[model samples]
Target chain A: MLNKVVIILTSILLYKVGGKLSLRSQLLKGILEGCILSIINIQPAYGYELSVKLQQFGLSDVSEGSIYPILLRLQKEKLIIGEMRASESGPKRKYYKLTEKGQEALQLFTHHWTLIKGPVDNIIEQGGKTDGSN
Target chain B: MEATEIIELNNEKRTRLTEHNLKYYEDMLLYIRLNGNKSEQQTEEVLLEMLEHLLQAQEEGKTAEEVFGDDPKAYCKEVVEEIPTEKRKNQASLIMMVILQFLGFFAGSYGILGTALHYFFDIGSALTTFSIGSGLVILGIDLLLLGAFILAILKWIKQSTFSKKEIKSWVEFLQVWAISTAFIGLIVVIHFVMPSFGKEVSIPTYYLAILGVIFYVLSFLMRRKQNF
Candidate 1:
């Protein structure tokens, strides 16, 4: 009985802590923006297609509707430009492409990601080694 | 086969699509308008993107709610908050409003404190006994409150960051301030001019006050109507 009560209490505590850890969402958004810039760095795509591309790359949490805001932000920053074009499928679609600045940003993001990935890999290889003996 | 037939068919298709999704679009627009403070053009752009997304979703045999989730209002609010607009004039006006409101609050408190000191503690000037100093203090308080109200209306008008046209130029703003002060000056002039006018056309102070009150109410209503 006591074991079951402790288990229930610990689960509740973890649930509360999990909900409070949404600060990582900001980190995710920054990384997602860089990923989006890199995707557009390859080819221009509309909002729906860009989101589908993200999903194809294993970003299942990004909804199609949510991508438009990021596109708007990029447009505002002059990092991307969107133009309305008649589509073969349906109505006119706004296709977005990276500007020269966006290309530079994507390159910087790639360079920084490469720099961080090595250190992160090293830490993970060490397998939680926190001892001073090294 | 004919050109007109193709146009009519397209119109029918568009109307049918709109009719099928009218409730969703209306709810989304209303929510964004109420909560996001977006301009008409911005709202229309958002709606166009949503319509395209909805059409694409329908083609895939899914409702917009299924694809984009059920809460479009919250979604639109989140989207609108992310994209910042260039509104230097609005920012300047907002800062001005804040400063003026701060000054107005201080002036009102000072006036009250001055009057209270005179009435309750007899610590103020002897000129207040003749109601000259006290009347000026009261007028100062009224002017500050009215100025704050006008600034509030200006701030509300300039909230549309999408529009380049400012609600008031510096010249127009100064004109409003001058004209309002001149009304109070008119009352002072009337009080002095009453002696020369004799008993025939003497305007009572209360009558002038009533006229001022009517003018203020009418102006407020007119301004609100114009903005909305």
Candidate 2:
């Protein structure tokens, strides 16, 4: 009986954790385009390479396929341009490079991000303090 | 690369995908391709890029759902929204081509059948009177209904893309049969109910057939020139 109770409780906890991770992904969607632009600003990259880089930078919550729509949007806006280049391992890969417009856009994103990040950080930190004091 | 070249390359690369992944990827392909106003070259280019990404992800043992997300329809919608639309002139030319082709086929078939019945079987008149006003109305109605039918079919196909439940073959057959029957029935009813007005022109069935051939040839030339 005790083992059954522990198993049931553990499953519920795992479910909640899974739900939280999905919620985090939902939140990440808003800033994913900016993140992509910043990465392309660093250096030219392809779709798979961009996803890998994002994962390397601790953005595992963003799905590998999710970056594609953002890439399309960026290309449409003329912020980045994709050119087909030969790859060593396989068929040709479309490498995306940031344009001058993209550079300006990335700088603007950084400014806006800095503005929002500091206040949000302070609020969360102060809210924790108030809870502790209470 | 040209759109045709990209399409050829895509066909070759797609065979490398696992069956499940191919199904997912093809759904996205179809959904994007069905969108008529988008730039064909850009669409094909993006599709090829997507196929490459999927292939790489597959090498790492990741399923399409893992890479593309579970909501394939929503993902496709986002991609479609971002792709550049075709130029207004190109879109107008395409519509004109379709209308011409439709007119050619309808007129050609009707003329041929009427001519055969009149000359070979001694059944009907070789010359028929067509009213300018009613003919235009009928053509307009046919075009509108055909457009609506095509759109509904496309919507149905897109909706089926990530559907969990399998739609039975019989149900699909019945749906297609019903829609086709309704379409034909509506056209026939319109032909009879619409009042004939304006100028009446009497032309031989063979002459009408010749005119249809002319329209068809014009449309074919336009298609070749435009590369649509």
Candidate 3:
């Protein structure tokens, strides 16, 4: 009986965690391009390296391969440019760096993020407090 | 580097992937490659980049699923959406190359066979008869049929990439046989129904062979210059 109860609770917990992960990924998708641009702005990085950095910075929910599409979009928009270069461990890799346009875009994204972050944080915190009071 | 060069490099580098990862990666590769109208250079470059990234992830002991997520087909669609289409000039050049090559091969084979029949079997009069109007109509119909067939085949291949069912070789063979029979049947019908109204120009079968050679050579040069 104890084992069955434990199994049931564990399953519920796992389900909730999976649900949160999906939700988190959905939320992250919007801001991911900006995050990528910011990282590239700091230093030029290849696809895998960029993913590692994002994961190291605690954005582990972001799928590592999802960056390629964003990279392609940024390239098409002329915001970033990629150059093929020799890699340390594998075959030649395409290293991406921001163009002037990309830098400007990054700045604009940063500005917009700043504008929304505080308001969003405040609203969420107030909502939490209201729930607590109730 | 040229697109062809990148493709060659990809072929070499992709061997490093594990069997499972290679299969997954190749599905994406074929999906992107089969997407017509995209810039070849960009397509190849992005494919190489993906291969390199996958290799790196493989080194870290991560499965392709972990890196790329489970829904690879969806991810491929996203990638394809961003890839730019080929320039008009490049597309035109490609079309010209195909048409020229087709014309060359058809004329060349007809010339060779006609020349052989004329000389060996003394069938000279039949070999010399040429009708420009019916010839042009037949060429037009052939080109249209060829284009449609190519598009259908490419669409079929693209749709099959993520399909769950196992495609049998016999089914594929039957499809090719059907298309081939249809193509030949249409040509035969056109020859029977269409009137030969154009002035009859009697030319030596050898001359037709020469014209075919010239077209074939032009196509070869264009292909080399374009490096497609």
Candidate 4:
């Protein structure tokens, strides 16, 4: 029991340390998926609306400087396509929609995420206790 | 929190964001705005988030008195840091290649002068013209060999993204080689070939050899640096 307790504490410590280390990667992964899902959950989106949604997930690193590169990369990869639509605000805004490939990728990503989330949520709900093995 | 409530975002604050990292910050904003379920109660939530970032900057010991402190370029630089560096070596290589070709052209001219000097000048005028012609040929060849040095420097400059010192070193290295080659050529001609054929075939034979060496050296360097 004592050894188990010690193991749990060490694992939690590692989790805390690692969370800080992988903050950017985690934030980017979360926001990227969230954006993709937002479009799938809806249809298409412009830059402004997507930017607002990314912030709500506690990701502050998604500045305009950071996000545009990812968008460009997605376009380059042929995962998404964009078209310009006139906005009530001022100029036309670029509205992006998932490509066929993007939709396929989103489906796979969702399936894998669901699989990974199960054990993860199990641990979270059980307060990190498991069946005597890692 | 009502759906009817509207909020105004300060255009000046929003316009301040820019980066050459292919619109990184823009993507970030767009992602948040589209995905965030912020209600109208959070009407200016998007703008407020950005405002909070600026406010946090002050809390972190940023200047309180200043309204907007950092320049747009400074923020742009930060964004650029997030992206990969551009391909610059190919550009530098092309520039160096052009310069090398020019040097080869000059070297070819020197060879022409060496051949001409042997024919045009008697022993009296031959010595001076011969020396100058030989020197320039070697100088041209030296420029060719130095092209390799330019490649190395270009590699260094591309990796560091600053300092053109490597280029300067290449130029100086080539200059030294040119001078040295000229001196050696003069010595070889005067000692061996200058004494033969009653001074008729004398200057031409040795001058040709020296020009040949210079051309050979240059050609070797040029072939090595084909810019491929």
What tens-digit string does per-residue lDDT give for candidate 1 at B78-138? Answer: 7667555525554444444444444444444545565566667877642212244444555
User: Per-candidate DockQ versus the true complex?
Assistant: 0.19, 0.63, 0.59, 0.14
lDDT of 2 by residue, A22-130 (tens): 5444345547777889998888998889999999999997778888877887898888999998977867889999999999988877776776667555655676675
Backbone collision count in every prediction? 0, 0, 0, 35
Off by over 4 Å in 4: A1-34, A37-49, A61-69, A82-95, A128-134, B1-228
Better of 1 and 4 by lDDT: 1
The fnat of each candidate, in order, is 0.45, 0.89, 0.79, 0.00
Summarize candidate 4's per-residue lDDT along B1-228 as a digit string, tens digits: 211221234344444443321133343333333311222222233233334344444445533123122243343333233233224664454445556455455545655675566677732333323344545455555555555555455443333332224456677678657655765565455444432222222243444446555655665575466423
Task: Write one digit per residue (lDDT tens) for candidate 2, span B1-228.
Answer: 777788899999999999999989998899888888899888998899889889988998989999889898888887888789999998899888988888888888888889999999998899989899899999899999888777778776767666678899899888878877888899899999999998999989888787788889989998888877
Give the C-alpha miss distance for residue B88 in model 3, angstroms. 0.8
lDDT of 3 by residue, A17-122 (tens): 4432354443455478789999999999988888889899998978888988878888998999999888777567789999999999899778867766675566
Which residue pairs in model 3 clash with each other? Answer: none
lDDT of each: 0.57, 0.82, 0.83, 0.46
Global Cα lDDT for candidate 4: 0.46
Q: Judged by TM-score relative to the true structure, which candidate is superior, 1 or 2?
A: 2
Off by over 4 Å in 2: A1-27, A114-127
- CAPRI-style class, candidate 4: incorrect
Better of 2 and 4 by TM-score: 2
Give the lDDT of residue B105 in candidate 4.
54
Of 2 and 3, which scores higher on DockQ? 2
